[model samples]
Target: MPCQSSEELNVLVKEAREFTKDGKVADYIPALGRANPHDLSIAIQYPDGQCISAGDIERKMSLQSISKVISLALVLMDRGPSYVFDRVGMEPTGDPFNSIAKLETSSPAKPLNPMINAGALVVTHMIKGNSIDERFQRLLSFIRELGNDATIQYSEEVAKSEFNTAYLNRSLSYFLKQHHIIQEDVEELIDLYTRQCAIEMNCLELARIGLIFAMDGVDPDSGKQIIPVHIARICKTFMVTCGMYNASGEFAIKIGIPAKSGVSGGIMGAVPGKFGIGIFGPALDEKGNSIAGIKLLELLSKNYQLSMF
Candidate 1:
C-alpha cells in the first residue's frame, strides 16, 4: 500500500534529494569516489510483483558493505548457525564499521557481529569452497538467485581498488588468522572478499533482493525458499542492529526498518511482510551511509507506517 505509484514516490525523492548536498562521495575506495554525489535513486518491490521507483533506478552501483548481509546469509546456509556463530559474535559494535580497536579489546577477539568489516571477513572466510574462484563463484551464484538476475556481476575497478587499499582489512584478517578464527591465506581471503563487496546491480535488482528477505527468504515468483526462515530472521536481525555501521542505533530510532547500507551509498531495506526498498545516493554521511537515502527511508517509513517496531 505504500508508494502506490512512481508519481507519489517521485515527490518523496525530490524532497529527500536535498540532503545529498550535506554528504560527500566515499573516496576511501578510490573507485567508489567516481560516483556522482548528487545522484539519488530508489526502487520498491512488493511480494506481488508490483514495483514503484523514482530517479535513475537502472543505474548500477557496487554492493559495498550491503553485500555483507547477503554474504552472511550465504555463509549461514553453508556452515549453519552453530559453526558460523562460533567464529563470529552475535552482538553489535559501537565503533566504526572498519575499526580494529574492538578486536584487540574483546576477550575472545572475534569481531562483534557480521555487519562490521572484521566480522564480515570472518563470514567470507566461512564460505564453502575448495578455491578462491570456486568460493567467489558460489557466492555470486547465490546472490544472482536472490535477485533473480543472472546478469549481476562485480565491478572489477571497485574490487581492485578496494583490494589494493584494504590495508586495515588485511590487519583484521591477520589478527583473526593469529587467533585461529580463519586458516586461509589472508591475501586470498581479501581477494574473494573484495570481489564480494564489489558485486554490482541497479536499484531495481537490489530491491528484489530485499523483497526476498522481507518475505522470509521466499521467492514470490517461484515460491521457493531461497533462504531458510531462521537464517533469514538472523540476517534481518543483524541488519536492524548493525546495518548502518555506528549510526545503526540512530537509524533504528528514526527509520526503524531492517536495512543494510554500503559505502557505495546503497541501502537495501526490507519492510517485513510488506515490501523491499533499494536506494542509491552516493553522498555519504560521517558514518558512511547514504544521506539522502536515509532521509528518503525516513520519509517513506513515516508516511506509510512501515516501521516494524
Candidate 2:
C-alpha cells in the first residue's frame, strides 16, 4: 500500500532508524563526527507541493557530498554542459570520492564526473567568478532559489574542520592543475568547493531543493525555473550514474531514483515529477552513503512506487 500520511512514513522512519546501530558516522571531519548516528529523518515533497515529514525532520546537518549535485547544476546553468563537461567527464569512477590513482595514470587525469570530490573541485573552478566569495555567493543564491529558503548558510565549524583536513582534495586539485583540467588558483577553487560542501540545511529545506529537480528544474511553489529542463535532466542522469561513489550502480538497481549521498550522512533523491525525498542519518555505509537514509529510501520507494525505472 502507498504511504497515505505522515504517520505511515513515521513508522518507516522508525524502522529505518534501527539500522543505524550497525553503521558508523563519518569521522574524517571533526564537525561531522558529532552527528548523532541514529538520527534519521525523511521529508518528501510531492509534485502538487504537499510535504510529508518524519523523525528529526527539523535537525540541521551539513550538505557534504550532497552539495555536489547542486554545485554541478549551478555550473551547468552558468556555463553550459559542454563547457562543464570539458573539465569533468560523466562516467562513474567505481572508486572512492577521494581516490587519486586515476589522476596519476589516466591519460587526461580529468575526474570521471562532478559528483566526486575531485570532479567537484574542477567544476567549482569552472564557475565563472572573479573571486572565491563571488563564486560561493552565486552558488548559495542559486541553491536558495532552488530550495526557496533564504536561511541556508555554511557552518563555520564544518568548514573549518573540512578545510583543516582537506589534504586529499588539495592534492587532487594540484593534480588537476598539472593535467590542465583546472585553470583557477588551486587554493581558491578548493576553498570554494569546501565551503559549498559545508552548507547546512534541515531535511525540509533539502526536500524542497530536490523538489525543483523533481519538477524538472522549476520551483514548484513559486513556479520559477531554477534550472533549465535539459540541465536538470543531465544533473539527474549524473546523479544516477555517479552520485553514490562506488555504490551508484547498486543504488540505481535497487532504489531506481537519481540520488546523491554525502559523507555527512544526507541523501537527496529526485523522483521526476513525482516527489523529492530528503533523508538524513549521520551513520554511513562503506560507500559513504547514509545507512539508515538508504534503507528508508528503499522502503519508501517500495511503498510509494516512486522509482523512475
Candidate 3:
C-alpha cells in the first residue's frame, strides 16, 4: 500500500497541481514572491527510512511561519511548558496569521498560539541569548538539528528581504510588548523572529524534522531524542489546531494530520506512527495554506486512509 514508487507519486502530483489556480504566491513579502507559483512538489518518509518524492523535489525555500514549530519546542524545553504557556496560550485565535485585532480582543492578551506572528514573537523573546544574533544562532542550531543536517542555515537574502519590509510583524511585537507578554527590546525580537523564518531547507530535510515528531521526539533514523516526548505532543496538538492558519479546522476535518504550513508555501506534516510528509506548492489558498499541497495530502490521506481521525 506504500506509494513510495516514483511513478505513482508523479501522477498524483500532476493531478494535484490543477488546484494551484485557486491560490496565489505570497508576494506581500516581496522576496517570497519570486517563488515560481506554478511549482509543486512533495516528499514523504517513513520511520523505516523509505522515501517518496515527486516534482521540484530538490528546491529550497525559507521556513517562513513553519519555524514557529521549532521555536515553541525550544521554549518548552528551555523554560518548561508551565512558564511558556503562562506567556502564551494553547488555544487557536481563529484570526488571520497576522491579525493585530486579536491582541486587543483576547483576554489576558497572551498570543493565542505559537503558530501566529504575535505568539511567535513572544517565544522569540524568551529564547536565551545575549544579542539578536546569538538568539537566532541558537535557534538556527536547533532547527538544523531537527533537520538532521548541518548545512541548513538561514537564507541571508530572504532574511534581508523580510526584515526590510516586515511592517506587520513589527506592529505585532510592539503590541506584545504593550500587553506585557514581551518584556524585551521590540526590534531585537523582531530581528530574531525574521531571521528564524528565513531558515531554508528542502522537502527531504523537512521530512526528517517531521519524522522526529512522528517518532515522538526521537529521530527515527538516528535514534536520538531531539526533544522531550511531552513537548513534542504539545507541538503536534498545535499543528492539528493551528498549523494551517485560519483554515486549521478545515484542514483537520479533511487531512486529519498534525502539520504546519508557512507563507513561503511549504508544509510539514507528521503522520503519527507512520510517515513524515513535506510539501511545497507556492500557490496558497485564501487562508495561506498551499493549494496543491493540501489537495495532494487530501488525496494521500483518503486513498491511503492516513488520516488520524
Candidate 4:
C-alpha cells in the first residue's frame, strides 16, 4: 500500500535478489568486508503514508557516499546555497570518488562536486558547530529528523574502521587545508566526514529520508518543511550528476531518476511526485554501485515508469 502495489514488489524483489550473485561486496574497509554478499532488500515510501517493501529489510548498512547528500542538505540549511556552493562547485567529476587529480589541476582546489569526498569534507566543515561532537550530533539529528526515526545511530565500529584505513581521505583533507578551503584541524574534519558516512540505517529508514527530499524537504508525516525547497532542488541536482560517482551519467540515462548510492550497496532514490525508494544489495560492480540494486531499479523504473525525464 505504500505505493500502488506491494504484491508486485514482492515478486520483483525475488527476481532482483537472484542477481546478487553477479557482484561482490565492498571490502576495502575491513568492516564492510564482513557483510553477506547474498543479502538484498528494498523499501518504498510514498507521501501519503504508504509503505511497500521486500527482501531483507532488517539488514543494516552504512550510509557511505549517500551521507554526502544529507550533509549537503544540512550545510545548505545552516549556511544557504551561496555559502555552501562557494566552497564546492556544481560540476561533476568523471574520476573516482576519492581522486585528488582534479584538485591538483584545478587552480582553486575546489572539489568538483559535493558528492565526492573532497567536496563532502568541505560541506561537513561548514556544519554549524563549535566542536566535532557537536557537528556530528547536529548531522545525526538532522538525519533522524528527516526520517522521523530517532533510533538511527552511527556504526562506531564502522566509523573507527574507516578512520583506521582513511589514508586517501586524510590526504584529501590535507590538500583542502593547503588550499585554505578548510581552516579547522584536518583530522577533526575527516573524523566528522567518516562518521557521517558510517551512520547505519535499514531500507525502511532510508526510504523515509529519501521521501523527505522527494517532497522538497517536507515530511508529509509531520506536515513540516525540514529543508527549504530550493536547497532540496540543489541536492537532487547533485544526486543526479554525481551520486553514483563516475557512473552517474549512465545511471541518469538508464534510470532517469534522482538517486544517491553508497558503497554499502545502498541506493536512495527520489521519484519526484511519486515515491522514494531505498535499495540494498551488498554486491558491487566495478563502479562501486550495487549491481543487483541497479538491476532491480531498472525493472522498477520500467514497471512504474518512474523516470523523471
Q: Estimate every model's Cα lDDT from 0 to 1.
A: 0.93, 0.85, 0.88, 0.89
Residue 226 in model 4: shift from native, Å? 0.7
Candidate 1, 26-59: lDDT as tens digits: 9988999888999999999989888999999989
Order by lDDT, highest first? 1, 4, 3, 2
Candidate 1, superposed: residue stretches over 4 Å from native: 1-5
TM-score on alpha carbons, each prediction: 0.98, 0.96, 0.97, 0.97
lDDT of 3 by residue, 1-309 (tens): 233547878888999999988889999888899888889988888888888889877899899988999899998998998999998888886799999887888889888889888888888889988888888888888988888788998888888888899899888888878878888887777778889999999998898789888888998867888899999999999999999999999999998999999989999999997889888999999888899999999998888898898
The sequence of per-residue lDDT tens digits that candidate 2 reaches over residues 70-157 is: 8888888888988888778888887898898777777778888888888888887877777889889988988777777788899988
How far residue 97's Cα lies from its native spot in candidate 4, in Å, is 0.7
lDDT of 3: 0.88
- For model 4, give the 10-residue run with minimal summed lDDT: 1-10
Model 2: CA > 4 A from native = 1-5
Error of 4 at 53 (Å): 0.5
Least accurate 10 contiguous residues by lDDT in model 3: 1-10
- The candidate that achieves the highest lDDT relative to the unseen native structure: 1
- Between the candidate structures 1 and 4, which one is better when assessed by lDDT? 1
Q: In terms of lDDT, which candidate is stronger, 2 or 4?
A: 4
lDDT of 4 by residue, 1-309 (tens): 333436788788778878888889889998999888888789899888988888877688899999999999988889988888788899989999989999999978899889988998888889999899999999999998886779999999999999999999999999999899989998888788889999999888899888888999889888898989999989899988899999999998888889999999999998886778898888998889998899899999888788888
